[model samples]
Structure formats: C-alpha cells, structure tokens
Target: MTAVQLPELPDLPGKRFPRRVPVRQILCLVPLLLVTVVAVRHRSVLAEGFGQLRTAEWPWLLVAVGATCLTWVAAAFTRQGAVVERLPRRRLLATQFAAGAANHLLPTGLGASAVNLRFMTVCGVPLARSSAALALYLLAEAVGRLGLLAALLVAFPDALRLGTLLPHGAVGPLFAAVGAVLVVAAGVLVFVRRLRTAVCSFLRTALGEARSVHARPARALALWGGSLAFPALQATGLAAVGLALGLPVPPVHMALAYLAATVAVALVPTPGGIGSVEAALIIALVAAGGPAAVATAVVLAYRIITVWLPLLPGALTLGALLRLKVI
Candidate 1:
C-alpha cells in the first residue's frame, strides 16, 4: 500500500508570510514613472515646444522626416557591410526599422544588438562570427562618428567650444570614476581565468573577421560609409528641426551641437537615451547660441519626427517580422 505524504508545518512561533515582490511589474512601471517625472518637470517647455511645432515651417519639418528615414537605409547598408553573406535587401531594411522600435525598449542599444544578432544567426552566420561582425560594426560606427565630430570641430572651431560646454568640477570626478571602474574590471579579468580565456578567444575571432572584412574594398566602404552617413543624417535632422523652429544657431553649429550632445550621452544606459538625451541636446544647443526656449522646441520637434511618429509602425513591422520568422 502506498502511504500519503503530509505537508510540513512551519517552524516559526508566529505566522510566516511570504514577502515576495512583483519584480516584472516594478520594471514595467519604471519607464512610465520616468516619463511622468520628465513630463511634469518640463511641462512648460513641452507646452512651448508644441506651440512651436504648430507654427513651425513645414518644409524644414519634412526635410527632418526625410533625414530620419534615410537613417534606416544607412543602418541597412552598415548591416550588409558587417557580414560576408548577402542579406535580403527588403528584409534588411525592415529589420532595421523593427530594430529601432526594440532599441527604445531597452538600454544602451541592447535591444537592437539582440535583434541583429538573431537576424545574423537566422541568415546562417555562426554565433561567434556574428558576434565578431557586430563588434566590428560598432567599432566602425564609433570611429566614423568621432571622425565626423573631429572634422566638424576643425571646420567650425568656434561653433561648439568644449571648454564652456563641459562643467569645470565634473571633469575630475568623471575621470576618477571611470579609472576606478576600469581598474576593478581589469582586476576581475586577471583573476578569472575562464573569463579571460573566453575574452581572448572572442578578440582573436573579431580581429580575424575585421581583417577579412577590410580586405574587401566594397565591404570596407559600405561599413565606414554607412557609419558616417548614419550620424550625418541624424545631425541633419536636428539641424532641420532647428531651422523649422527658427533657432538662432547656424545650421553647421546645430549639426556640431547634435554630434556633441549624442556622443556625450552615448554611454548612458537609459532606454533610447530619452531623458538624458533631451537634457544634453538642450544644453548643447544652448551652448551653440540658440535661445533656451527655441532649443527646447527644436529638440521636441526632432524627437517627434524621428521617434514618436515612427514608433507604432516600427512596432507593427517588428511583430510582422517575428511572425514571418525573418528575424
């Protein structure tokens, strides 16, 4: 005969209640909270921004929209450059659009990186190689953006004077914090042999992949050219918005301001750099000699055209791609 088991009794003298929290619920509400806070804090600015948008030049806004669209094409070209295998042209562009939606849902490009990684694997690229390609694409894009920024600085020395832009007191603390983090990271890598080995292997693969990609002139051109175009288009969109809002800053200065603001906020892990980017862009534009109210309006208009307007369609496309299993 089988015996039935009885439930165990609690050992505590009093009742023991579970204190578990809903972590997923908390996470879901965080972004909403941040958005609410930002909205309340900048309510007046947003009101003026909306007013400016209503009265803004339609032609310049249209140009900003066009530039925003071109960024997708640039992303597609950069993705094509990343791998030796040819990806379907239409699908590649669709993926970039979908990836943009994903990008705003997660921090520091994680969402886009995940989507692209999956796409590469679906296209029959090995995981290791795909990762290498991703690394190469990011490195190329960063270098291209910095190069563009440097060239602009050279061309317009007085446009965005860094000395006034960066706060005096923050520099030392920023460098110190960065140095401490690097030192700790280095210590961990030195102590953990397994992690060290894995990292070394990945680096080797990435270097080899980079070498092969550079050997092909077309691939090299596509990678660097697309990288350069992506940021240039982004800056153009900002500049167009500035024009639309009649910001006093010159077009070149606006472009430089865009580059400086974005580059500074790149390391921020906030989703789509929403809060941080808005703040940085406003500061940069103000430094570029645009009036505060006008700069706020330009940033809002640019974000609306580039981000909010496209978000829903991009999400729908993302769902379609997932259902079709093209990603």
Candidate 2:
C-alpha cells in the first residue's frame, strides 16, 4: 500500500540543496561566540552602566561619529594616494569598507591584508605598488600610535602608573619582553650581514623581481603621513565618546589609552581583537584617570560606535566586493 500510494516529488535544481553538511562554518562560529561571551563578561558591570548613559550628553556622540567617519576617509584616501591605478573615489571607499569588515572577521589579521592585496591586483596595480601602499599604511599606523603614546607620557607623567594596572603582573613584563625582542631584531638587521642580505632577498622574491621605484621622498613621506591621520582621528573619535559619557578625559589621556588598547589587542590575535580590545581599552582608560565604572561605560560606548555599529555595513560591503571580484 505504501508503494502504490507513492506520489513523485517535483524535480529541482542543485540536487535539492544536497545532503552534505557544512562543518567549517559551524566550527568557525564556536570560537567567536566563546571569545565574545568572555569579553562581555569581563565588562558586564560597564555594560550595565551603559543603560544610564542613554540620557548623557549626546553632542559628543555626534562628534565621535564624525571623527570616526573621517578616520576611514583618511584611510581610503591614503591607499588611493599610494597606488598608481586610478579607481574612482567610490571604489576606494568600497575597498576600505570591505577590508575593514574582513579585518574584524578573519583570523590573525590576515584576511584584511589578503583583501587589500586583492583590491590592488584587481585595479591593475603592480605588485610592488600594492605592497608598498600597505607597508606605507602600516608605518603610518606605527607612527601615529607612538605619537599618541608620547603625548600620553608627557601629559600624564603622574598617571603612568604602570604597576597599578597590571594585577596579573603581565603587562609590564610583556612590554619589556617586546622591547627586548625589538632590540634583538634591530641589532640583527643593522649589524648582521647575513640577516640583512636574507631580508633583501626575501623582499625581492615576494615583491617580485621588479625594481622598486625611485620613490619621491616627499610622496613617500606623505603616504606615511596619510596613514597616521586615521589612527590619530580614531583616537580623537574615541575621546569624543569619552566626553559624551561624562568621563573626565583629556586629549592626552585619550591618545594614550587608545594607543595602549591598539597595542594590547594586536597581541591577542582574536578576530578583530574582539573581547581583548574592550578589556585593554577599559584598563587603559582606568589607568588614564577614569574611575573604574566610568571607564567601563566609556569602553562600552566606544565599542558600540566603532566596532559594533560599523560591522553591519562593513560586512555587507565585504560580501558585495567579493561577489564583484573587487577584493
């Protein structure tokens, strides 16, 4: 009776979506959720305080948003200035959006770098030009960060209470450890002939056999300058958020906290630094003179505007760009 009553199912395209399961996608999200929950718990108190901030001064929020927008604008233009390929401004912006989204989504910061390189290739930019542009951007990021750090040091000499913030007793030692590595690396690059030659060979192989352009000194400097503007603006933007939440913040403190957060999150290697960044930011804010509760609130609002809000638009752009083969 069962066989006699059988009715044929309509044929369908793509084999009825197949029975194969997607395992990597399911796996990909497990770590992200775990990290996000951990980061959130660390800031639970601050997040609770966020509800009260709904009635806080909002003019600063407006300024913060504007500043953040400008930072991305600077980033887009910086890349445009470095590459010889002449994509329209709109395309440059698209590339930045897509790259930023990927920056947060991918592991160990490699996704964004790949997306950036792909953008350059699609635009017919020679390999050297593309690589140099990114390298220029990185140099700028470093310069801006150091400048922020220096400002914080000068402005808050009394507040550089490093020992107070690192209760786990790692931040200070970690800082020293990095410095030690840097010194060793510099010594090798500067004095070791074998290492220097090896580095040159490596650069040549990866950047392709093409001769590096005799870069115009002014242009190269400008490239780095453009790179600095983004982070500088971003720090300012975060400071504006600080002001909005009624945190007692000075520009110097803002710069320092931002710089410290950047450095700290880079070490965590989480996708876009996630919970690690929020914790670093709150700690840095507290060290920079904010009360613990207010520091937490400020960090929450900071994440809201800078990380959470932009994620949606940036992600959509990433999908579009990938679909279009633009990056």
Candidate 3:
C-alpha cells in the first residue's frame, strides 16, 4: 500500500498559533451597531423624514445649502487667523473642505485637527508652531461657542425648557462623568512626567501665539469673528432646514436648540458625535415645541445637507490634495 501523506498545513511564518481576531476593530464596530439599531427602531421617523423632503420648499432648502457651503469658508478664515504665517488662500480653503470630510472618520474633532495640523506643517510652519496654532484655534472656537450659547440663552429666556433637554436624573450621571474626567486628568498630570512637560511646553507656545495674534487687529478679528460666525452659520443651517420642513419652532428658538444640542454632545467621543448629535437635536427641538416627527425630519435633512452631501466632494478633494502633496 502506498504511504498516505497529509497535506501540508498552511504556512505560519513565525507563530505556532493561528492569528488572533482584531479585538480593537470589533470594539470600534460596537458603536456603529448601536447606531444601526437606533436607526432601525426609528424607521418610522426616517420614513416621515423622506416624506417631508418630497414636499420641502425649494427656496428654503437652497438657503440651507448655501449656509452649509459658507461653513467651509468660515473654517478657512479661522484657520488663517490661528497662525502668523500666511497660508496659500486656495489651498487653505480646500483643506478646510477636506477637513470637514475627515471629521466624521475619527472621534470628537481629532480627524479634522490632524488634517489641519498636517496642512500647516506642509505649508512651512514649524511643527511646534503648528501644534500651538491648533491649540489656539480650538481654544478660540470653544470660547466663541460658549459665548454664543450664553448670549442666546439670555436673549431667548424661554427658548429652551432646560428640564426637557435633560431628563430627570441625567444631571447626576453628567456630573459623575465630569468628575471622573477631572480625576483622570489630575492623575495623568501628577504621574506622567514626560507628558506633563510636553503639555506645559505646548501651552506656553500656544499662549505666545495667542498673544501675537491678538496684537494684530485684523488677525484678532478674523480669529474671533470667524470662530463666532462658524457656529452661527451652523445654527442658521439648522434653522433653514426647520423652515424648509415647516417645523413650528421659531428661528430664535431653533438657533437656541441647535446651540444647546451641539454643546451637549461636544464631549461625546463617537465619530462626529454621530448618535449623540441626532438624539440631542431631536430632544432640543421637541423641547422648543416642534412635533417629534417634524423635529426628526429637520435633523435628518440638516445632516444630509451639511454632513453627507459634502462628504464625497470633500473626500475627492482630500485624495487630490494628498496626490499633489498639498497636505
């Protein structure tokens, strides 16, 4: 009888065991799965959203589209203000557009930040200066947003019924989360000597840059004005959608709702605040007295114009920029 030969096992270059599954990839997918489930559960609202789109007023929708376009311009101007070195105008604008697309791929604002940081360095800014400029930009943006929110809340005293925005008992969890973050941050600063030194150096550089930018009136105006306008334009876009869909909320109230929702979801680390933003916007709109179905429709339409519509063109632009070595 011929000796039987077992087929050779598939090659394993170095290990004796098969490759392990990617736990990190699977963990990242969990949030996406949760978003899908939420979407499925609210399929009815989304269907209503489609119906609302069919009957949406063309002129108001057009205005919303324009506002969305202006957001990129606002971002570009703000970016220019962040650094003293002059950036190429057309390339800067293109980078802002591409940054918007990149934003949805990573948690919080990291993807956009990374893209802009790279663009600055490629434009001949030193790495230390670019990092400092990024920090300054973020600082200005946060301050502008908070200032706007305060102004809106004050001017439209009854615009939002706060209780509706935060359901009973949510305040406790929110406080707890904030406390945990503070504790962790303190621990890091205390224990991580290298990280602490780096952070201190970065902060000193950022402060110097901020002072220099503010000393120039035009740069100061561009930095603060564009930062303020960016959020206002975003809120206006939402208001335009509300108008297009015939939501009952007044423009001022709608703006208030937009500001509140965005601020509430700002700390959420999900990519572009995906699930948190939608939920917060819907809740805020309802609190502002729009019907739930109509509010849902408005959020869906707003996101389409601002986030999804520009995504493809922005992505193509990113690829072209990469090929040209512009970023």
144: Cα error in model 3, Å: 0.9
Tens-digit per-residue lDDT, 7-84, candidate 3? 999976875787899664554344344445545655765575556667889899999899989989999889999999
Given candidate 2, what's the lDDT at residue 109? 62
The TM-scores, one per candidate, come to: 0.85, 0.73, 0.84
Tell me, by TM-score, which candidate is best. Answer: 1
Clashing residue pairs in candidate 2 are none
**How far in Å is the alpha carbon of 139 misplaced in model 2?**
2.6
Give the better candidate number (1 or 2) by lDDT: 1
After superposition, candidate 2 runs with Cα above 4 Å error: 1-53, 84-87, 167-199, 204-214
TM-score of 1: 0.85
Off by over 4 Å in 1: 1-51
